[model samples]
Target: MSRRGLLRTLGTGAATTLAAACGVPAAYVAPSDRSRSDLSATDKRLTWANWPLYIDTDDEDESRRPTLDAFEKRTGIEVTYTEEINDNDEFFGKVSPSLMNHQETGRDLMVISDWMCARFVRLGWVQEMDRSRQPNVTRYLDPQLRSPAFDPGRGYTVPWQSGITGIAYNRRTVGREIRHVSDLWADDLKGRVTLLSGLDEAFALLMQGNGVDITKWTADDFHTVCEQVEKLVRTDHIRRFTGNDYIKDLSSGDVLACQAYSGDVIQLQADDPDIEFVVPEEGAELWSESLMIPNLARHKANAETLVDYYYEPSVAAELAAWVNYVCPVPAAQDILASAKDEETAALAEDPLIFPDTAMRKRLAIARDITAKERTEFAKRWNAIAGL
Candidate 1:
């Protein structure tokens, strides 16, 4: 349910196959051809596709989503929410044809990792949102996330939820603190440390540890990390590369340290205080799975309304409490801090939820890996990870 770590396991093999099928065309959609009819005046409904257990569901009813319900009451717009996006690559294969051929993808709006959003943006497969209509989004969205390399000016995408990729370890078992990414390779941790298996998942932190600027990391910087990891793999210094399975290892005390996600580590700490997540002194990646309105969506304005509604601090705080990812609306931190319950109030201060200024200064949104970089980089990375 930690959709934060859900990006990498979307299966590179499936994405590669999809890439072949979706050969980029010479033609592209023009600005004039992007907009469809303004159906918001007549159609009171729109369909949304998202990952499972992503939204906050009613504890008692299990079927109702309170934040979404409130949106309907406020605007009279009905949403047909579907949890159909289990994997990014698989979902791309399903919808790419429709998008590329200028057909309706049967989804008015959707969410996908920022790395993949780069592809859609480059392809002109999605429509730009009207900034004038999204006052809440324009006001409350994190400034750090406003102009990612893919969506400059953020005219196309809005973060659905945000999270950090950093180091997590069982401090009690490790018997020392891990303050830097280099600490994972310390002699005492040999054959007991795990890195993520996916190339996109694993690279940024390693690169950051070496002082490479992830916002504009060069190919030489990438190769430097690869060389170091390859040496570790050969010496058996790394126990193995893994996905979210690292959670079980850290919880069971089978592995003392591993690459981890902030959101997942927060949940783990509730049950096991020994598990600690850290943003290494060097840096960490600030990532978001964003909301994008796909091309030719009939209910474009309606979808924009829903997107902006979530940005209101009170609504964002409600969602953040349930989903437990880093809230995109930093204003929500104050809202959660003033909660009536002590437990809810503590979340406001949790560095993992609302990262402090120090942590914020160290985090960077990595530039999207390009189409040309994908094939060769993945080939080498997968070989080293033995995936």
Candidate 2:
């Protein structure tokens, strides 16, 4: 099936309502009669689920992650880390059956994007974290990410790493400056740009252009923005909607500009220095791929320890340097600043990594679509895409 079809299929009111009830409708699991592991005492093992290529692995031997290995050696807490998450919805579909049934998901902790995390928080599929055990998180996490609309005060979700949804353009090909979201729809750029296909990825900047405060956006505001997007579509102002494939289009000069994630833009920049990414004048969405403990995990305590371990400045810096995404721990910026390699040291100044105050104001955390809204909007969006 096309990506649009798949998204519409999973984004139904029933699925969203179910998701709101179970914390992750896509990964909903029926409760298993089988008993959970009794690790209330000295449970030494933890099962962590995350996306592929998220963690640093041995350069030659991919089997090992140095930081995780260190944690095991120092604390004797064995981690069963699995990169089972690919697409958010795909992974959700894989695990939803277990969540709905109130059963053990066979994994302890998982990482998912913040927008989806909101749904999980709403459904109560994840457990509230013990803040006492995560003192480093309290100290080092960026103030901006601490109290998102999804989990106020971050009682349940802890951002693993954050990134920006911004504009990326090929300087060598475009031969013009593109500084704002409005610039994307200029006449000359008509067929040379792409927007993110997913609603969560594309909505914030579009809404920001209208000067709406995203944190408190109303349904009328959403529809108003949709009407504007529909106009853009009718005018052929938008070239196409895309997944990560926008990277390829930009590289080939098929697309001169497009909506892009900061992490992916960094990779493109490394390959072709002429590729430039900007967090547009209207502002961009600052998002995270976060960590949460599942409802019936046997190793919740061990999982908490692992989560805290990553929040340490040094550990966060190491991960941030490798992932090339925004680090949630601001203290890590200092650590990166002192790096021996000039390349790594210069990362400390990258606004996308540690957004300065000016950039921070431009960034907003847009609310995730409510269950009814998801069904309503998804239908409209899918119809436009001919899904």
Candidate 3:
């Protein structure tokens, strides 16, 4: 199953509802209380929570994650890794109580979508990582991903893997090339194109389609896209709203073109060469599911060490090979290029994995929907998409 297939359909509604009931001020943690005294000097272990199938797992024995095993071996820090995160809002609901109370979540590290990271950063529910200790990250992190609107300079989050939100189409089935977001609206694609259902997942690319600057898109810009999408839905121009199931539709030829993630397209192309993913001429949303250290994490220093270790070009290349997402470390491209395995070396040249200069020019990380905007935006979006 694709990673997104496991995501909950509710999006951020659950968390937003909880915040409304409890009141935002009551849940906010003061900055001084966000940290706890470090135990990393003596505690040689840390627990990490992440999404399923995210890390590099051994083919023969799925229990063994090569990169993680190497981290344990190289630095005597034993990691207790759990694939416990299934959805962004679901996971947020799971841990928000502890975070709101300023208590340890019993997790040293975790990964979630950057949009959710913005929520935690705003609530002061996560600790800022010390970059001085993360030399590889400081040197190799992609410049394009360095300063998202929520976490300027990436002070609180590190991208675990990145992907592009763009258009994916079966070229032969479509019988034409799709160069812009406008192409999906062509009369030929009526009742054949699908869109993402989740409010956070669907909005930016649609706004980008209208030539809006997603990084600083205004409320008027958001409502304009909503109006357009509502019209598409009413006229059956869109077959339906979808989650990751768009992959199934496209693969089965039910849909010819749809909004898709870059990583999923890579896997699809391996099976059917006709599958093509495009960063539209107007632009596409560059997004990431990022790593973060929650407030009062007991092994903060040990977790920081692990984060830096993965930033090393060689290590990043190995992880990138298996995960097939955009590598946050661009330096890893050279490492993959020099690998002995032919298939592995070819990955170094995949623009989806390491985007080319021209492609990079069109990629932008959208500004996160704020606490003030999420409820209103999600309500309008959910009503239209029927989520």
lDDT of 1 by residue, 1-387 (tens): 355446434543654754564454523677777778979989998999987778998999989999999999989999999987766667777888788788888889999888888888888888999878899999999998999998998899999998899999998989989999999999999999999887777899999999988999988998999999999999999999987888878888779999998999999999999899999999999999999999899999999999999999999999999989889999999999999999999999998889999999999999988978877898889889977
> Where does candidate 1 clash, by residue pair?
none
In the order shown, the candidates' Cα RMSDs to the true structure are 1.9, 4.7, 2.1
Q: Encode model 2's per-residue lDDT on 1-387: one tens digit a residue.
A: 222223334444433443354344344333342235559367788899987778877888889898899999988988888866656666666766776677778888999888778877776678878888889988888898899877889998999988899899987777888887788888888877788777778877778777778788887887887787778788888888877778778888889899888888887788899999888787788888899988888988888888999999999888888878888999999999999999989999987788888888888787788866787777676555544
The lDDT per prediction is 0.88, 0.79, 0.91
Deviation in angstroms for 378 in model 2? 1.2
lDDT of 2 at 116: 79
Candidate with best TM-score: 3
Model 2, global lDDT: 0.79
TM-score, prediction 1: 0.95
Off by over 4 Å in 3: 7-26
Clashes of each: 0, 18, 0
- By TM-score, the better pick of 1 and 2 is 1
Pitting candidate 1 against candidate 3, the one with the higher TM-score is: 3
Clashing pairs in 3: none
Candidate whose lDDT is highest: 3
Q: Sort by lDDT, best first: what order?
A: 3, 1, 2
